[model samples]
Each structure stands twice: as C-alpha cells, then as structure tokens.
Target: MDMFEDDTPGNAPEFTVSELSGAVKRVVEGEFAHVRVRGEIGRVSFPRSGHVYMDLKDDRSVIAGVIWKGVASRLETRPEEGLEVVVTGRLTTFPGQSKYQLVIEDMAPAGMGALMAMLEKRKQMLAAEGLFEASRKKPLPFLPEVIGVVTSPSGAVIRDILHRLRDRFPRKVLIWPVAVQGKTCAPEVARGIAGFNAMTPGGALPRPDLIIVARGGGSLEDLWGFNEEIVARAAAASEIPLISAVGHETDTTLIDFVSDRRAPTPTAAAELAVPVRGELLAWVAEQGARLTRAQTQAVETRGRWLRDLSRALPRPETLTEGPKQRLDYLSDRLPNALRGLAQRRRVTLSERGALRPALLRGRLAEEGRRLEALSARLRPALDRAVTAKREALGYRSDRLSLRPISRDLARQKGDLAETLARLSRAGEADLRRRRDRLGAAERMRETLGYKATLRRGYVLVHDGEGQLLRSRDAAAAASGLRLEFADGNLELGEMPARPVEEGGDPAASKAPTPQKPAAKAPRKPAKDEPPSGQGSLF
Candidate 1:
C-alpha cells in the first residue's frame, strides 16, 4: 500500500552508480526510442569531435540535446541558437554528466513559413548592405576558360549541369563538393566560393573565370541554406562572376539576388557559361571567308585600276623619239665634216708646191707617205672600235633578252609564295577546326554515357542473372542483387522482408502498395572515367 516500502534500506537490493545510471539510460531510451521534440534551440556548440551539443527549450522547461557527428552532418537545418526547430531522436542519459539528453538523428526548421520569414529577414539585411544591388553584380564571361562549381559532388544537379554543358559547350569545370541542403551547407558553399576566389589565376589549380553555385530543386526548408546571409555575402563579394542556381525556376533564394546572374536550373547555368564550339567554329569560318572575299575583291579592284592607268599613259616608242632623232642628225653630219677636212688639206698642199719645186716635191712625197701611214693606223683603230662596239651591242642585246624572262620568273615566284602562304593558313585553320570538333565529339560521348549518370548518384541494379532490375518490387523479389555504382560494384544478399504493422487491417494490407527501394551510398566516379560535357569556344 505504501510506495516507500521498496525504499527500505534493509530490504532494498543495492546498485552501484554505474548500474543505476545504466538502468536509467535503458528505461529512458526504451520509452523515447523515437520522439519528435519541437522547441527553440539555445547554447548550440560544435565540439572538436564534430558533435553538436545544444539546449532545446520551451517557455517553461529546457532539455539537453546532442547530435552525433554523422547525424549532425546530415541535418537539413543546423541547430543554431535562437532557431525554432523540430528534432527527432532517442532520449538517453549521459551517466558521466548526470543528465538525460536527446540523441538527435534528424532536425529541421519548425515550418516552411518560419524558414521563409527568416530567409526574408536575411535577404533584407543583405539588401541593406547593398549585396543584392545590381551595380555590385559582375557581367558573366562570354567564354569562361574554367568554371568553378560549388555543389554536391553526388547529385542529379551536378550531372544535369555537366550534361547541359556538354550539349552546349564544354569548359574545364572545377568542382568543390559541399553539402547542398544540410547543416553544413551554408558554410561549405561559402567556403567553396571563397576558396575559388583565393586561388591564384595561373597556379597549379587554375582559377575559374566564372563560378556556379548550384543545387537541385527541393522544398523551401531544404533550400533555406542558400538564403543564409553568409552565402549571400560570399556570393556578392566573389571576384569571379557567380551564377546562382539554387533550385527550380520559381524557387528564388538570397544568393539569386546577390549573384552576378541567376539561372532557373543548374543545367541552365551551364548553358549560359560558354558558347557552343561548333557554332563558334562555323562563325569563324564565315568570318574567314568574308575576309578572304574582301581581300580578293580589293586586289582585283586595285589591279583593274592599274590596268586603266597603264592604258592612259604614253607609249615607250613616244618617250624614245627625241633621242632617236638626235642620234640620226649626228650620224648624217659626220660624212660632210670629213669631206670639208680633205678639201682644205688639198689647197694647202698646192700652195706649198708653188713655193719650191724640188723641195715642195720632196715635202709632198714625205707628207703623202706620212698621211698614208696615219691613214693605215686610223683604219686599224676604226676597225678595232667597230669590233668593240659590235661586241658591246651583242652583250647588251643578250642582257635585254633575259630581262623579260627573269622578271616573269620573279613575278611567278611571288605569286607561288603568296599561294603557298594562303594554303598554309587554310590548312592551319582546318586543322584547328578539326581538333575542336574532335574534342567536342569526345566530350559529347562522355556526357551522354551512363557513367556520367552514375557519377550523379544513380546506381544500376541488377538481378542475380545480371539483368537490370527496373522497379522496387522487382528488386525486392530478387534473391540476389548487384548494384553498380560509379566507382565500384556492390553485391547484396537476399532482400529483407518488410515488417507488417501491428493492429493493421488485413484487407488494407492486402492491397498492393508500391514501395521505393532504399538509396545506396553514392560513390565517386573513377579517375579513368571521362568527365561530362563538350567543348565551347572561349
């Protein structure tokens, strides 16, 4: 009848402090094996071991809460001081601390409305700081040499982006893996953005010309981290142009406003980042053709003008007529001058003969002999001069004969050189174009392959016979299964039976209810596997 009867010291069974604590822990854990507690968080602390310790309090009572490192990392929303949250976990006593605490497994903000309100408040604060100002936004690069991505390494979002980039244009993508929608999401995303900006432009890790902050579509609560003030501020302060692709088209976050550009989806962000390589190559070819045509037309027009000017100029014969006439006049006067000299010499000889007969006769004989000798010398000299002149004329004629052919050869050589240069340029252009196309094709093949999909967190499930299992029912029915991940394969034993709910209606249970298979841990893609996406012109 008395509750204190068991407390009698003489009849009571003894227990050490350890046993008492252990018993208390078991009872408490069993009673609260699964519970959901809604309260405001306070005194939140993240220890060096990565566990979170916090106090969950209501208006009247406070409860100590603890999130293990793994569970804390998986929380959709972090337990922050002054944040209204709902946590699900089991309650157990920490014997050393002499207190009962909640071992939280999952946590989230109280409601979507509450999260949105918080998001709005943060947005307002960032706006006041001018982080969302249009003036602060940088223009996206027309062609980014390297694109930095802050996103989950294993998600459909990354795959979509890579695939889209490959379809449009390929660029070097540097991925900074982070939690997209969890307790560490904001900080990790912010860190990724900052880390990219911190890199040296041409260092071992090349700096990205553009940045993309991306995540898949989720509920407002799941996407709340993008609305955090830290993320917004980081995006605003980034030196590299950033594109925000937090969620679907309608799901806007603070990052969307602060980033240089906002894309409706991750794929859209990739599409905006670079130009299609094929199209760029085509454009280059078009411009080159236009240039060639313009040059050819200009050359033709100049040549026509030169021909017209040549026709309008005087002839070579007309230019040489004066010199020809002067030469002819000199030739005609030479014979008359020689005849006058001969007549003058004859008159002088007659006068000398009349002065003295014998003396004059002897003198005349001497004069005649001297004149004959002089004439002989003059004749030989004239013959030599004629021979020399003939040889000189032949030499000049021979030189003249070769001049035209040499000039023609020089002109042909110049034309050939110009042709060869043009051909070389064309060849280089073609080679460059082919190389770009080959690269694009290779990237396309990679992007379109199943390996890329696997890297995006998809797994191919196979039955014992190695046939692909498409449905959850098929997988559940299979005796043995194999899962092919991006990096490796996992062989699974028989599927476990689903536990029937107690006190449930049998008829209701008999109705076929579709069940989804549990998701497996994602594996990173093998290094040997090619990355997704085609190439674009930078």
Candidate 2:
C-alpha cells in the first residue's frame, strides 16, 4: 500500500450533525415509547417557567426527569427530594444537549411503604408546628341547628350521614359537594371547609353551626388527599367546629389531628353533631314538671311564713284610732289660725293706705332726679359713641385701597386725551373745508366784478363819497370825481355843471368841466393778463 492511501477521499456516507441527532432521538424514543421509572428523587427544581425538573436515581445510575407545566399542576403527589416515586412517561432526547431524559406525564409514590414513610414525615413536620395542639380545637355545638357536610354528593358517605342525623334529630343540612380522591380532593375539601365558615349569619341562607368533612373508607393511598397540608391547615383554621370522618376506624389522616372531634365513621360523626330528638323532648318535659312542683312548694312555704308574721302584728282598727284623734285636733285649730292671719292682713292694709299720697310724691321726686342724672350721662355717652364711630371710620379708611381709584383716573385721562385729539382733528378738517369754500367764493366774485374790467385798460368813475357815477351829469354834479383804476384811485377837483339852454344839445351841455382834472396814468396789469391784443370788453 502506498503511504498516501489514507489521504484519499472515501465514499462512506454523508451525514449532518442535526440528522444524526434526530436519528438517535427517534431510536431512543421508539424503543422506550412508554416507561414506568422507579427511583428515589434526588434533586427537585421548580423554575419560574412552571415546569418541574428533578433527578431520579438508583444506587448507581441516575436519570434526568422533566414534568411539563401542564402535567405538573395535575399531579396528585408532587415530587420531593428523598421520596421514592414511580413516574409514567416516555423517554425523549434533547438534540441541543445531546442527552436523553424522561418526560413525566403521571407520578405517584412507589408503593404503600413509600406512601406511609412520606405521610409519617409530613405528620411529624406539622405536629412540630402546633397545628395539632388541643388548644386550637373548638368545642362542638350541643345541637347544631344547621349542619354543613363536605363530601362527594354521589357517594354513600353523605347518605349515611343524612340517615344517621335523621334517625337521631332532623336538622337543616347544607351540602357542599367536593371531590374526595385524586388531585382535586385536597383543594376542593379545603375550599369546602373555608366556604362554610365564610357564610354570613342570619342571612337569606343561614350559616351552618358546624361542619363535617366525611369520606368513605379507603386505602391509605386513596385517603391521602385528607393528609395533604392544605386540607390539614383548613381544618385547623376553621372557625366553625368541625368533625373529621374521612375513613374507617382503622384509617387516620392529617385532618383527624387538627379537627375539633374525630368520628370513627360518617354515621358516628352525624351522631356527634346533634342530640336524639325524643330524648331531648322527654328531658324537657321532665324539667317542666320538676319546675312546676318547685314553684308550688315555694309558694306554700312563703304563704305559711306570711301567716306567722301576721299573728304577731297589731289590729287594723287599733292602728286607725290614733290617726283619727290627731286629725280632729288639727281641724279644730285651722279656723283660728285663718282668723288671726286675716286680722294681721287688715292692720297692714290700713297702715299702707295712710301713707299712699306721700309715698307717691316722694317717688315722683326721686324719679325726676334720676331722669336728670340720666340726661347728664346721655350727652357724654352720645359724644363717646360719636368718637368711637369716627375712629372706626378712620381705621376703615386706612385699610381702603387706592389702586381702583388710580386706575379709574388713568382710564378717564386716556379717554379725555383721545377726545381732545378727535376734537382738534375735527376742528382742523372743518377749517380746511371753510377755507376751500371761501377761496371758491372769492374766485367767483373776482370773475363777476368791475375790478376785472379795470385790469384790462378800463377805469371806474366814483364820487367823493365812494358812490359810482354812472353818467356825466352825476359826475359833473358831484363835488369831486374819483377815477378808480385796477391799481389805485385818483381824485379830480370839483367839476362845474355846464348850463344847458332849452334848445342846445343836452348831451354836450351835460359834459363836466372840472376846475383841475386828474391826469390818468396807465397802470401795469396783473400777472394773469388776458391774451395780448385782445380788445377790452368795456
């Protein structure tokens, strides 16, 4: 063989890590499909995930066991360290860890011996806690008016109890049906006991006076539910007196130790709950007869004693004779006492009548003096009242706030300023409007007046008194003629009226002849002169 022979690739088979692990898992699970493992529990773990993990081991070999969350809660007996248990489940492998484990579907104590050992151990633990103390037990009622029974309704235990109770004394019974075996038994029984105690007294449903937790005879394994810690504590904590009749005389449970009374059987528990009705009625009748006889004897004894005491006492007539004589003595003196009282009252009335007028005058004078004194005090009192009122007014004034008045003043000031500004603006606007109207009227007057003609090389003739001279006759008859031009006025000397003969031309004769004529000068025209060379309208 060549040395490189081992280096050559060979065609054995192709396999992945996951495929190999899966094949191994299938083989292990198929071979041990369902198994019952018997071993002592070594380690117990209850993680927050609710699944239970434990180690089941023999002397040498150990196996990891897992109870899923769902199955863990339904289990009757929870796994504990050092407890021998038989677990029923299938074998499975975890590919991630590459190890095999048992998935526990059901679990129980390995045998009767294992159950007894666990029970004894639990018993000792509870006994150390004072739960089994006699002081914790309550006294059973003499004859409970209402009885609460906790048991399976379909079971023979409840029927036997009812029959026994009826034969003895019929009572109102409240039945709280509960599971009596398996995983549900412990919690249901605990709840039943607690429920009976939680009822309200004198309510629509009367609260039971006593509670009886009963079950039919069974093996220790079957009755193990009563031995649970919850059932035992519920029995110890019951407020109502409880009678435990869980099994036959030979059977014992944790409840037997904590309950107030224990009966050998359910029927015996019923007997303990109530008294026999016929016996009770007969006893009551016998007590009544005895009481009646005692009452009659007592009456006769007291009557004889009263008779003996009567013989030693005085007679009735003798007792009244002394009182009658005393009453006659008192009646004879009453009229004399009344007459003496009337005489004293008459003497006192005469003395009071003699002094009536003087007493009235003295009273009037005293009253006048008192009135004057009161008047003297009244003015000062009034003055003091006024002074107090003024001080109070001053104090209140000091406490008054000025901010509101200041704010009002500021607001009024602002309003006044706004009004003044509005008035000023209104006055300015009115003045501007009036000025515009006035300017319009002035322009119109200039356009329609004689001064417009005077500006265009024409003049106006007026008399010295400032009246217009329309014709030459008026000018000649005036003392003086004034030539008015656009720029200024020039005065002419007095004009002589020429004589007009009746036939000569009157127009020529009316022409003026002034002693001294005013020389006219051409005045410069205004800036707004008409177009050059335009003839004057005059």
Per model, how many backbone clashes are there? 5, 0
Question: Which lDDT tens digits does candidate 1 get at residues 245-328?
Answer: 989999998889989999998988988898888999999999999999999899778766755665675555554456556655
lDDT of 2 at 225: 94
The TM-score between candidate 1 and the true structure equals 0.45
Highest lDDT scorer: 2
Best-fitting candidate, measured by TM-score? 2
Residue 463 local lDDT, model 2: 68
Candidate 2 residue pairs in clash (backbone atoms < 3 Å): none
Off by over 4 Å in 2: 1-33, 93-100, 314-538
lDDT of predicted model 2: 0.83
Q: Give the per-residue lDDT of model 2 (tens digit) for 170-235.
A: 999999999999889999999999999999999899999999999999988789999998999999
Tell me the lDDT of model 1 at 297.
Answer: 95
Residue 279 in model 2: lDDT: 97
